[model samples]
Target chain A: MTLRIYIPCDAAAVSVGADEVADAIRTEISKRKLDATIVRNGTRGMLWLEPLVEIEEAGKRIGFGPIGIEDVPSLFETAAHPKALGDIAEIPYFKSQQRVTFARCGITDPLSVHDYEKLGGLAGLKKAIALTSADIVKMVTDSGLRGRGGAGFPTGIKWNTVAGTTAAQKYIVCNADEGDSGTFADRMLMEGDPFLLIEGMAIAGLAVGATKGFIYIRSEYPHAFAQMNRAIEIAYTKKILGANVLGSGKTFDLETRLGAGAYICGEETSLLESLEGRRGQVRAKPPLPALQGLFGKPTVINNVLSFAAVPTILAEGSAYYQEFGIGRSRGTMPIQLAGNIKQGGLIERAFGFSLKEIIEVYGGGTYTGRPVRAVQVGGPLGAYWPTHLFDTPFGYEEFAAKGGMIGHGGIVVFDDSVDLARQARFAMEFCAIESCGKCTPCRIGSTRGMETIDKIIKGEDVANNIELVRDLSEVMRDGSLCALGGLTPMPVLSALDHFPEDFTPAHQAAAE
Target chain B: MSQLPRKPTQKTEAGAYDLELVREIAASMKGLDGPLIPILHALNDRFGYVDDTAIPVVANVLNLSRAEVHGVVSFYHDFRHEPAKRHVLKICRAEACQSMGAEKLFAEVAAALGDSAQVTLEPVYCLGNCALSPSAMIDGKLYGRVSKEKALAEVRK
Candidate 1:
């Protein structure tokens, strides 16, 4: 039997030298003249041990890594390499995850349709093929699935609205533009199991009565973009997409479109505008994308995770998915642990895992060994949570209650040495840099906010400037068109509220 | 499939790029849905950056105004107004990477390679490779857990 070895081709894995490791493994096998075959698979979410090499042994894949080219020769020399991580699945970080959407990610060859089907890929699209569009919408509704792209809008309602609308040519657009600073779940899912998203979009097209779909990925994700385009090509050639869709005699074809680097384009309306070949400017709501979207026709826009969830929800039934999570926010969220953390990686869990547990337990605490001073949950617009609020649960409403958001489910931890005032300024600066400039409040308020923070930092008229920041934030929060402006104050206010010492002038406090 | 710049191919009317070639590329992609962005991307791919002269040619083919075409190109950070250096290096300046001392890494890089004509340094919000914080991509290749030494060595090569 040929010895089967698996190594990840996920971009993050490649970023840290997985390709060099793969080459080393190839050379070692050839020089030793061993009967071995290498399979480039997706990451297992054990990112701390990335460039993770797995060898098939007695039906169990044994893991070893965060491997280097230097460590390659030792692998064939002895069964006991120092970095040997036993069984890949048995690792606590691997075992702890309630892997649902990510179930087949690291296990199968990403573009392999046979591997995708054998591991329960098309079961959802197949199941949806037998059902009416209304029944499909109802099934998703019962499952309590919501948009995974920061906004907690119900996916079924969005589908139902589009299904209700009668359009000559409806469209299904997958928002694979994962632009958040700490989030990579969408990228991981797209690169690791490109077919799941293809299957998800196909099921969506069938449910919404659309024949064409597009997955809009960011220009930054060239690896994922290449993989998705290739996978879509394979999908079309195999008759799995277009004219037949797994021989069910229904039609659905998916295309991958690349976005120019604009953060606002990640917004659905802005995305639709960009897709229409215009500058990514936000459009006012009244006609939601469900009713008037993509060439002024009905569109079903869902995040990669939201669409990827459908396959399992359709295959296993609504009740099975609904039973996994806390109230309202049903199903698992792939939480990303990033920055200043030792075990930073992807952690998918049910909705109630506390921020403390995620950061300390799964993340293995700060990478610097200093105490974690603050954890920013969500992306650039998310609130800065001081340690006192670590008990906050990881759900939609729960986070909202604490004036924080589970936006895109990304948690970025910072050590005690950080200055909150600097972070607050960076937030404003980021908003100013990325704002679509369609709305005055976001465009102007961000610049003014940055100047005000600088005044505070200089200790010149500190109190008034600090008050002005609050005033400016309140205006931007209410007046801006979309979340880009509306949520900018979350970080600004949260920093002032929790870490006032960082904002206070040393001389002024001493005088007081 | 490549997102990075390629070598300038076939000179144009203003000694910048080929005008007829621009019209041909634009017309070829005009049949695509939302073809304008793809058309601009094609020009950029061929010339390493969208030449200003090609704007009217592309606009004429797509029947869009010069302003509309220029607006889309200038609005996005990825579209360069002029040719990028031989190597383009983008450092992640977003929140996750920031927490991992990317600010310091950036400062060091800027101080070193900021003036070098061989490399054009740029700031990117996020690369979706956050698990490996302090990430930088040079010439469409990603590097993670990047120390100042590692980043300098990679770019200097």
Candidate 2:
């Protein structure tokens, strides 16, 4: 009997030497003439344990991680190696997760459509193939599915608009241009389970009248690009994609396009502009993307998670997925726990979990072993929540009410040594750099805000500069054309609100 | 104090570019939906930077104005105007990396690699590997947990 060994080829795992571990395993197997089937799967999102290796033993997979080339030979001898963590499902970090979008990740060979299908892969698309287009749209709409892409727009409504629109051609644009710092769930999804994204996009095509799709991925994600392209090719061969999708006489084919390091391109309009081979400048709204998008056609532009969630929504029926989450937010969110976190990884859970639980329970506190001072939930534009505000629930409205966001579900932890003044300054600096230069408040105001923050830090007219910053942030929030300018104040103001001492002369003097 | 240096010639040295190669690269990628950005990226990949002279060639091939081509080249941060040194080191300067002491690591790396012509250090907002913070990318390959020692080794190599 041949033993099945699972090793991750996901970029995050590879970064920590998974590739070398794979190579060592291959060489050892060949050297020993051992009969083993090595599967290059995706990371389980337990990043601290990556280059996580798993071996199938009597229908159960045993896990070992932080594995190196030297540990490979030892892994073959016994599963009792120092790095071994017994069975994978038994691991508390993974056991706790209610993985919906990331279900196939770290469990199957990414490129193998066979492996994908066996793990309940194409059931949603299969169900989608049998349903009427209106029924499909209604299913998603009924699922209470909102856009997972920070904005929290209703996914089903966006599709319904495109479905109703009369056009010769429409497109399903998957915004894989995940530019947020603490976010990599999209990358993990694409690399680990590319077929899921393919199926989701295909379902989206069936839901809407769109026959074409495009995944605008960032150039930085080389691994995701290769995996998704390969998966698309395999999907085409299997009749999962192409003119007659699943022999249903429906046409929906899409290809991946690489974005050239423009953070603004994450915006749907800017993404459309870049997709058309122009500067990634944000276009004016009132012509929402659902009406006039992607070469002036009705396009459904959704984030990777939003699209990936569709397959499960269609497969298990809307009621099952809708039942999990709290408030208006439904389904599970793949929260990327990153930065100073001791157990940094992806945690997919229902919406009602508070910030305190996510950081203290799942994260195992900061990596530096210091008391956690602050945490930045969402992305670059998200607010910095001090420890006292840790009780804020993870729901979109809940977070928004507390002046925070669950942007792309990226939570970055920070320790006691952090200076929030520097963080506030960085927010303005980031906005200034990434702003598409289309709006004044985002472009010019960010630079001005940075200057004001600098003045506050210098203790020169601190009170006046703080007032000036508040004024500038208000204008940027209210007056900007897009969220780039609008929501940047979420971080700046939150940092100011929480860590006011960081800006004071007394605090600076004490630190010095 | 009328210092008359009439017009500071902003002309970049251009003769190093292969005009035929530029045409070939543009011609190969002409079928793509949005060919200009792809062609520029291909050109940037081949030559360390997009040559100023190649802009006219691309504009001519794509049948667009030189300004149109140049606008795109300047707009994207990844599209460098000048040739990169032998190596380029991008340190993650985003909030995640900051939480993990990237600023201190970045300063140390900059100081260690001070004024070295062979290597260039630039700050990237994020590289999407926040799980392992204080990450750096040396010539496109990402490294996590980029301690001062690891960064120095990578630079020195």
TM-score of each: 0.97, 0.96
Looking at candidate 1 chain A, the ten consecutive residues that score lowest on lDDT are A503-512
TM-score of chain B of 1: 0.88
**Residue-wise lDDT of candidate 1 within A461-497, one digit each (tens)?**
8889989999999999999999999999999999999
lDDT of 1 by residue, B99-144 (tens): 9999988999999885898888899999987878899998889888
C-alpha lDDT score of every prediction, in listed order: 0.89, 0.88
Q: Model 2: which residue pairs collide?
A: none
* CAPRI quality of model 2: acceptable
Overall local distance difference test of candidate 2: 0.88
The DockQ for candidate 1, computed on C-alphas, is 0.54
Off by over 4 Å in 2: B1-16
